[model samples]
Target: MDLIRDDDENNSISANPPEGYVEPGWPALYSALHQDPQYLYQPYAIWRFTLYWTLLFYGFVFLVTGLLLLLNFTKRHPRLALLSFALWILSSLLLGLISSTIVAYALAALYNAAFLRMSTWVPPLWGAVQVLLLIFSAAANVPFFTG
Candidate 1:
């Protein structure tokens, strides 16, 4: 008795896929792999995902700083505060987003290659770098600090 079917119509798992069936590319493959429960449960995957969230949280830091400036300085020097806020948005926020994106992608790659134990420090190190950037950017734009 024949174990394998040679007829293409009868065979469900054919050696050659039908026309117009495009194989998933690297981004699709990575997306599927990242969604897998087993892959997500791994320590490296956890840290890699966490790095993305950490970047988002850093963005919130800028938001809070802008809010605080509006609340405090609006009463005394509204125009100066508004200009400072605009400058902060143009300089600090844009710089932070660009820098964070680069760092986050780099850190995710590192997390993929690093051992679980070594990967633990990636988020904190990223946080420290962001904090320094935040300080410098704020000082460069803020009226009091610039003076």
Candidate 2:
């Protein structure tokens, strides 16, 4: 994101760096991480492992959600099915990440509506559950991890 913004060819010639543009300060964070003796001596292999595992987990979730939509399964309820698909589409827009977290939360609102419409007490579908799970994952990463 910063690279795109920093490039004069991409941004307006008059564009100035965004707020808090201190070059040396950013590297200090990584340097601080290394200052910790535990992390300083650690091999890059462990970092690679964390990266791969994170990718695998997220990729599996995305693939499964998409496959559920691709197959005829979620179509059992047309409205909710399309709603679920729309949720995924919206995520692609990065409105959830850029605009606001509320965008991601709207999924739960839709889920509640679906539940209200459906007469059953059981969990209607995984749309709501998946959304919540994603929210949890995002929060956990944003707070402590480098996602």
Candidate 3:
């Protein structure tokens, strides 16, 4: 079935807009009007990129656990093994969040430059949620330590 029908024209060549023609910007109430096309695509790209990182982090955790299991760390030096395992998880979580934030922002900037009229909410919103979670987790850990 033909989805995009151009009944009038024999040639299927789509007419290109003028060199600087900007598409209508997304009607995002919370977002400002983007100056460049790239801005429009940033939020969506960041959202997608962060999701990939999530999977990557999970895979990394699994790989670490597998390696640790093979080494039988839990069977010997149990306390040290537990400490190392906890540290590894904590470090990986922090590293993933930190790297995701940095890359998302950087790529969002690049997207903003390359695309027009894209929504700019998803990236910031997701990033905010992550930051909040990180803060909450850190706060919960504070009571266990003494200066």
Candidate 4:
């Protein structure tokens, strides 16, 4: 299988190359993974939905924990409180990591599709977006912080 090369002389481009000769890039990958290029939108939509629900769960937990703490729920049920705290921290951390991973995968999928153009800047921009979201999620509890 021969890879397609850009012919400068002809100034023409082949968007869909023949099968078995998958180009060593996102375009080829996108074509291979999806039967219809429009399906490329699915992963990103799912990623966003997951992030939204995860954040919502975190906010609900924070509120419930804070309210119970006011009534000295921890002192009454020390073990339960400790367990809840531990679980909340671990789950949130795990979810964040997983969310970032899914986002990265979605970005790769986008690259394979025609939605995102190939560029060196993509990696850094993606990293920055992930970092910013993590920071925002972490800071969501600031208003309830006793300290």
Q: Which candidate is the best by lDDT?
A: 1
Residue range with the least summed lDDT across 10 consecutive positions in model 1? 23-32
Winning model by TM-score: 3
Which window of 10 residues has the lowest lDDT sum in candidate 2?
37-46
Rank the models by lDDT, top first: 1, 3, 4, 2
- After superposition, which runs of candidate 3 have C-alpha atoms over 4 Å from their true positions? 1-52, 58-70, 116-147
lDDT of 3 by residue, 1-147 (tens): 643322324422122223453433333225245553232333544545464544364446545664675468877777877777777666666666665767676656654454333344544455445545655676678966534
Instruction: For residues 1-147, write the lDDT of model 1, one tens digit per residue.
Output: 744333445533223334554433212223334653112213334344445544555556766787788788999999999988777656655665566666655655554344222223344467567767767886899888766
Query: What TM-scores do the predictions have?
Result: 0.40, 0.24, 0.42, 0.34
Residue pairs with backbone overlap in model 4: none
**78-100: candidate 2 lDDT, tens digit per residue:** 77777777676655444323322
Which segments of candidate 2 are over 4 A away from where they belong?
Answer: 1-43, 72-147
Q: Which is superior by lDDT, 2 or 4?
A: 4
Cand. 2 TM to true fold:
0.24
- lDDT values, one for every candidate: 0.53, 0.38, 0.51, 0.50
Cα lDDT over the full model 2: 0.38
